[model samples]
Target chain A: MAYNLWYWPGIQGRGEFVRLSMEAGGIEYRDCAREEGAHALIENMATFDRPPYAPPYLELDGHAIAQVANILLFLGDRDHLAPSNMNDRYWLHQVELTIADMVAEVHNVHHPVGSGAYYEDQKEEAARAAKQFREERMPKFLRHFEAAAKSNEGDWLIDHRWCYTDCSLFQLVEGLRYMFPKRMKTLEPDLPKLIGIHDAVAELPGIKAYLDSNRRLAFNEDGIFRHYPELDAA
Target chain B: MAYNLWYWPGIQGRGEFVRLSMEAGGIEYRDCAREEGAHALIENMATFDRPPYAPPYLELDGHAIAQVANILLFLGDRDHLAPSNMNDRYWLHQVELTIADMVAEVHNVHHPVGSGAYYEDQKEEAARAAKQFREERMPKFLRHFEAAAKSNEGDWLIDHRWCYTDCSLFQLVEGLRYMFPKRMKTLEPDLPKLIGIHDAVAELPGIKAYLDSNRRLAFNEDGIFRHYPELDAA
Candidate 1:
């Protein structure tokens, strides 16, 4: 059965993470907000007895499962995008949760004073946040992911096969490159494993088709990874 | 078998969320950093083949499980702290993860320009961040949780049971009250169900004993929830 995925219409934001997994797993899903409208998504959310706090919730069977990582976890098990063993499954989840932490930090870099204020309003604070993210946080998170990838005897995060975490890592690298081009360029050589995963994921049949189609939203100022020239450093 | 929980020693930060669950569940686990010292926690983290990105990791049966929600999920299943049914269990996890999101945001209020800098160094931005958090973010999160608590037939987040999410919600309310006393005082009346859950969790036999013990670290500036007079408004 096709699932209903509800999110904000325009920007990929967090929703793209779920979309990437579904596409890579070859799972059938409807982009509810894109197909209908953001208003419809909002209305649909309000109707749930246990409503999601934010967007990127998936309606599976009849229930709405929210949170990017949580949605991916369910899909991983259902669609076979993750390892079968319990230990590796939990490991994959741990990696995804860590990726989620970095994604939150990445968003904070552009909205240092918080999301209530616009980036233009918080430019000065964003500059400071961006510097720390580039200099300290970025390397710290990437190195941990690299070590995780190396720990296993394969190119993927958990095992020989590309799991949902690999899809997320690809999105993370892509977003970082879009948000901090100079910083990523300087750091990419050190992150060969992570970069390799991104390249490999791009070549996956389903993901390639998804990326080539209009379904993959372009990175823009409205999304989580907003690019500002002032926030980038070489 | 007892588990070893590694977290920073000084404060009831993210680790406290894990502690609350273990305490309420009556599970035996050593708080590694508090007993052995923070240096030990650091040294131990380095030895993991698939290292956790940050601490609050639990060593169970020779392997480490990281991330608060992921660990809690594992424990929820293993220790009987969550619903046994798959749908309710996933819902419990969704709530816990959303609580995790708010916890991250709550920390960010004090360190809005990023954690590399001190709150003193970013007080100006902190003021802005705190205002938005106290006004918009906190209520938005608490209301969603309140709705979740009310959605079910009983007082807990799930079907009449005190699941791990309830443990987390208790901690969330406690931290908010400590961090933003005036704001929480103003907001608490509207959150009757959530406040009820918090109160109920506090009275649980294990939690009561744990809180009265010295092991329950006091909320301080060093932790995730810090009281700043300037940050709270009536």
Candidate 2:
């Protein structure tokens, strides 16, 4: 049976994380909201037995799994996106949540006021927010992730294997590059292991196939990670 | 062995969510960072092999779990804080992320530009941010949660049995009441099931014992959920 993935069609946003994990794990799934329409997502969400608080929810078998990290956790166990050991699984989640925190900060840099408001309207605050995000927050988060990757001997987060954290690190790097090109150039050198994780994930057979295909959505201004050249700096 | 929870002392903040989950589950854990001096927290994080991005990390056995949602997820699985079934566990996480979203907005109401700056530095912007949050975002989030609770069985998100989501709901209500008493009073009538979940969790056996003791921290200016009268609606 195919799982149903519901998210906005126009942009990747948080939904791309779920899509990446699914594609990497070779899971059969439908990008329902993208295939149908935004209204289909709305209707499906309403019809859900236990409604999700936001979009980017996945329906497997019959259950709808919301939250990007939670969806990855489900897929992690099912498709070997997680490490086999219990402590390994726990640490994988810690790294995943760290990725989610960065994602949230990325969104905040664009919309510091409210999601209801446009970035253009909140540009002044966004600039101030972006300064902290691009300078302090970005480096600090990258350092933590760098240390996490360094703790293990091998390239990936859990060493030798590509887990969900690897896929998320790839997205984080990709999104940061698109969002803050100038800042990423400097930060990249500070985190070689993270770059290795990114390279390894990009080389994953299924992920490579998905990225080469039309299924993968590009980073647009409509998504969480938007490129505002003015918001970037060294 | 007792778990060591490391978070800044003096406020419920992000750490409280983890505290509530452990308390509700009847798990014995120490408020490590709170007991240790603030300088110790800074030093401990500096020495951590796999560094945490922020506070509210739980050190269990020898593993350190960071991120509020992640810490709760760890305890949920270990102490039976979540439902046994896979689907129920997924839904529990879905609801928990929504609570995380709510908590985030609460933090943003005061620190509109993110926590890197002081409230005085961004007071004007924070006022506008708080207005949008109190007037728009809170209602939308509350309605989504109310619908979610209603769609599930009686009290909890999935069924009559209490889940980790219930503890989060309790924190949401407690935070809202502290931050926006007037606004929450008006919103409460419309959110019966949401309120019921809060009430149920508040009266849980372990939580009652925990809160009654000095183990539970009160909401203060130092924490995420602060009570600034101006930020609240009169």
Top lDDT model: 1
**Candidate 2 accuracy as TM-score:** 0.96
TM-score of chain B of each: 0.98, 0.95
> Per-prediction interface RMSD?
0.8, 1.4
Per-residue C-alpha lDDT of model 1 across residues B132-177, encoded as one tens digit per residue: 8888898898899989888887877777668888989999999988
| Runs of candidate 2 exceeding 4 Å displacement | none
Error of 1 at B194 (Å): 0.4
Specify the highest-TM-score model's number. 1
lDDT of 1 at B168: 92
Candidate 2 chain A minimal-lDDT segment of 10 residues: A56-65
- For residues A1-234, what per-residue lDDT tens digits would candidate 1 score against the true structure? 889999999998999999998899898989989999989998889888887889999986668899999998888887899988888888899999999999999989988787877888889989999888899999999999888878877777766789999999999999999998999999989988888899999999999999999999999999999989999998
Docking class of 2: medium
Model 1 vs. true fold: TM: 0.99
